[model samples]
Target: MSLAALINQLADEDTSALKTLSLVIDWVRPRPQETIASTLTRMEQLEAALTESLDVHLAVSSRLQSWLDNAQFFQLLSGLGLYSRRGFFKEISERLYERVNPAPADRNNVKDVLFLVFNRKGDDAWIHEVPDEALLKLLGTLWHFSPPALERTRIRVCTQILNAIEMLSIWVAAEELEPNILRLNPRVVDRESAFVALQRELAAFVQSYVRGLQDEDEIHLDHDHALVLIEQCRDEIARLQRRSVTAGSTMALTHLLERLSQTLTRIEHLLDILDPADKEKRTRRSIELFKTLVQASAERHGVRTLWRDNLRLMSRSVAENASDHGEHYIAGSRREYLAMLASGAGGGLIIAFMALIKIQILQLGLGKGVETLWVSLNYGLGFMLIHMLHCTVATKQPAMTAASIAEKVEQGEHGRANARKLAELLVRVGRTQFVAILGNVAVALTVAFAIGWCYTRLEGVPLISTNRYDYMLAGIHPWQSLALMYAAIAGVWLFVSGLVAGYFDNRAAYLDLAGRLRQHPLLRRLLPLTLREKFASYVDEHYGALISNFVFGVLLGVTGYIGYLSGLPIDIRHVAFSSADVGYAMSVFIPGVEAFAMFTGFALLIGGVNLVVSFTLALNVALRARGTRISSFPKLIRAWFQVVRENPLALLYPPADPRPEPLPDNHPHPEAAEAGQPPSDVTDSSPSTEGNR
Candidate 1:
């Protein structure tokens, strides 16, 4: 309805206050595709119309006042804040349940009235989109039209705010006392600790504030000391988070810490809103709080948001572990670069034998299921052996190295110099990857060709039949086959395997697996003390890699079988294996030079897809988990181009005098420095030379 028409209707004595208020809201709301300026103009027009017509002004003023006076507000203050009284899992299930089956509204509660008035599904979207200045104007108009809230109502609201503070303090204290939190910070058990003192101070403040409210004397209460205590509690929470990096963290502990943090923040907001002086500031704070409550109510039933909110802490923990492991994958100096090449050569040698075994198994003429099982075991066991021998699979480096690069990007300061440093780091990563791939492809091809020649000479038959050779060539054909697509699939598995490795690493730390192994009675009885210690130490360091390699192999092996069962095209192609296949095919029958070049070009393309896909995926997750953004991307790209222009060979090979990159001042892992140990980047570790595949 038009503003004039709404004003005329509201001026009529027979129009109910509720219906009149609803009409005004409908008029003030933004129309579809309407600009915020247009909405603001309409709002001003409505306010002007009410000003001119005394009857309409009186109608809106009296009705809104009555509504405010009658509605209960405690639930609005305590319940609508971003918190829950239930446990994390229970809250998640309840939110999901409520999305499917909403509860009946409470007519007397202001919280319910908000949902009634903003009944549209996307009301929160527009409300959130509105600028703060526009919202303040709206609030000013409402305050001008409606009478001031009664003294009794003001007292009641203050009481509710105090009650909320009390409840939040209790929740924070209880969460802080959880066993996991105590393990992280045992000082929480002391009576003098911030967690305990916060509860005591809040109680005293409540009693004093309430007594002053009742007496109506000059109220003089300072919450600054209480705020200080809260800050200390927050520091303790931060300490717990830092300690969790080395001590390890579980989902339950993460959830508890997140809840405690939220509760403390809510308490702070309540205390700010409850100040008896500074009436104007209090009104502004209240309006801001109301907006927050509305937004929370709109999203209360969102399952995806709930899940994301709950998993954020745990994801960070896992990513932290992955980042630690990823540091070993980046080669900083010429020596490390050579070590990577040697590792790749070792892995390629093993992969050649694995490829031969796979071909022999295919020749068995077994059923699809049985063949898949044998191939999976061959790949899994081969990868595990490669890891044990400190070998490297060229394709697997991208997923791990990408995380290391992200850490650098995250730590970098925002400037041209930082961007240049990052670009230099990228150069190191690229050259390391290049040498590894070269080693893998060269060694695998050479070994496979020798094996095929030796077998044919001894047995008087070609190792690969002509028919099998054609099929293998066709499978790797760039345009004619799904080789690139299969390589992309393999890339995704590679990223998932990195996550699996991170998870097991976290599990090992959280469960104290090394400690358990060292103390196990069976190990003590079965082996000498030195052997047992060595075994436990080895397992602690290599457990995640061993498990990840096996799992990655299984995933690769099962894709084609899954495709066969479902009648779809699904498979994996690794560059090293494809190179071996090419060698075997050449041994069976020589192809033309063009065909051979085409085969090599497509093999490189497959490797490119594998690297790009996994690196992109892993880098995206690592950045998000760290809550870091490379806002200087354009500058970073420019820096990278400048480096390439200045020295193109730097990207393909290390410089003659390679130096180790120093750790940044704000390195994410500070525990090592604190322990008087060199940073992981500066020290060449055993894992640095091992296979990360």
Candidate 2:
């Protein structure tokens, strides 16, 4: 039937007909088959007819005004053609609560009437196929025009309005939209629509929204997929920009271009962060971004969003454990070099003793479990003492030092000249490592040889049998045994120790462990204030390193047993300990100079593998943890070569000038001491050895 006929037939007293017409308006659903022009034409006609019909009814009867007074009538009118005048409709919302305050029952009565008008009909009401055009017109006329009290209306009213808006969102053109109009388009949908302009706008809005989506919920996107999607957006923006120049810049075109530029900038920023080739730059940005995301979680979830935010708390606490570890890497002068050397020497002395203990333990003829325990105790207690005494373990430097360097790099230390800076840093590290290793191996070999010589002199027999001495010598030879593979395994253990140190450090800081320990009731009651405070402070500073060192000892102790269980020949060969083993072999067994030289040479080579493989792995992890990446190996190698050619001694000796390296401006770590300070220690002893106790 014609819209005019429907409007003309509606009478003030014919409430059923008026209600039916309201239902007809609410039920209008848009269909894809209809053209835009035809839809708009129908809408314009229906609105004019409905408005005129409502005006005539208002003029003819007091009943129309009474119905307008009823809240239910106003709600139904909102679904029909009630308040087309935007200004007056908006005022109804402002004064609605005031009106409802005086007689809330009037509002409830209105709701009751609405319930009967719509709920009683149910799905049968939806069967009436109201024209999409008419529904669109009615929705546009009444949208957001409801009285404030109607805000609490039932879901049926909300659903009708939402359906209409969703349908309208599909038809509305971004170019034609005014900011004043309420548009519910989410701006997050994939837009491959025919409307090129709207597609760009939608993509831009979605991208902007995505950057802040933790406020909504988490979203994880594939790195490659995000890049491809961004590339498509870039192309579309360029195409739109070119067209805007030819079409002449309208206000809409200018706004669209601005959004496109902003979106392109955001896409580029994300791309820079994700690029694998740009490791240094990527890591710095990623660290900052991760930190920001973590901060936002607090803001969005309000500090302890779920379960008092234990994860973040624990990470921060664990990070604090690295403070002491970090300080072990920074060297500024000759004094620091000697300190590091002394620390290494001290560690080597203990490692030599540990090797002697291991050999004695192996001769006990105990089961593997008992053997593992004794060996662990021998290594763990020895290393714990080394750490307490502040001695050095050469391979452990990479993991802790990486975090320190990453912090420095993150403090605006990157750009075109980053390669040179990294080269300088690497040189310092190389020299420090060289001296430490020298101190360790030199002392350990000397100590082991002296111990073996003294023992043989006292007992009038060799410390190890001739057969076992040959086996130790042959084990160091790469082709005769798995020395290289075992060295690599040691390297892996070194890397793990670094990670363990970092994790515990973070945990300490996050949990405020020192303060918590100080606050313990027993400690407060039993200890003096000074002692309690000191104890807590020590734990806060040294707990992670202590735990990591002990764990590392256990790991080293179990390697052979694990490999044996798995029917493998896995073992570990560390440089300092191996050199000491070779020294013992030379003292007890080897008679020929050629044989002694080969064993010594092979032991040194095994040590080299252990240091290189472990340090390299540790460096990689540290970079990743800090969201930093090393430049390609070729680039780093070239840089190293350039530094070497300029000054060959830099990696072996301290420079004459010896400027103190500055701490990073934003360094959060608070490690207790510097390189020249008392050195920390861990054992590098292998798990097995020679003769009976």
**Top TM-score prediction, candidate number:** 1
Give candidate 2 regions above 4 Å deviation: 1-327, 407-417, 590-594, 632-635, 658-693
lDDT of 2: 0.58
TM value for model 2: 0.51
Candidate 1 regions exceeding 4 Å error are: 8-25, 81-89, 145-155, 211-219, 274-288, 311-314, 405-425, 590-594, 627-632, 655-693
Tell me the TM-score of each prediction against the true structure.
0.86, 0.51
Top-lDDT candidate index: 1
| Cα lDDT of model 1 by residue, 1-693, tens digit | 776788778777776545665576677677888876777788788777777877667666666666666667777766675556576689888877876888987766778767666766767767766676777776555545422365666777787788878877776767766789877777766646787789889988988888877897846466888899999999988888778766778877776776678778878888888876676777667777777887777766777766766666667777777777776888877788889999999998999999999999999999999999999999888999999999999888876777777778777743433888888888888888888888888898779888998888899999987789889989989889999999999999888888888888778877777888999999989989899899998888788888999999999899999999999989999888898898788777767889777787777788888888888888888777666778778998999999999989888867677456774543524576467665555443535323221
**Candidate 2, 1-693: lDDT as tens digits:** 466555554443454423543534333322346544554555566556556666534432333333433334222212221111223224345436434553333422443343333332222222224344344345444332345423333223323322332222233334224321112122324544223443344344344434433233544233454445456655654555443322222323333434444434433444455453567776555444333332332222122232222332232223323433565676646778878889889888888888888878887889998998899887777777788889977767776766556554544235645666667777887788878888888888889989999999999999987777877777788998999999899888887887687776655654568989999999999999999999999998887788778877888889988987899999888887788888887778546888767776787787788778766765555454334465465776787789888989777877676566774433222352333222133122312211100
lDDT of 2 at 15: 49
User: Model 1: C-alpha RMSD to truth?
Assistant: 7.4
Residue 435 error for model 2, in Å? 0.9
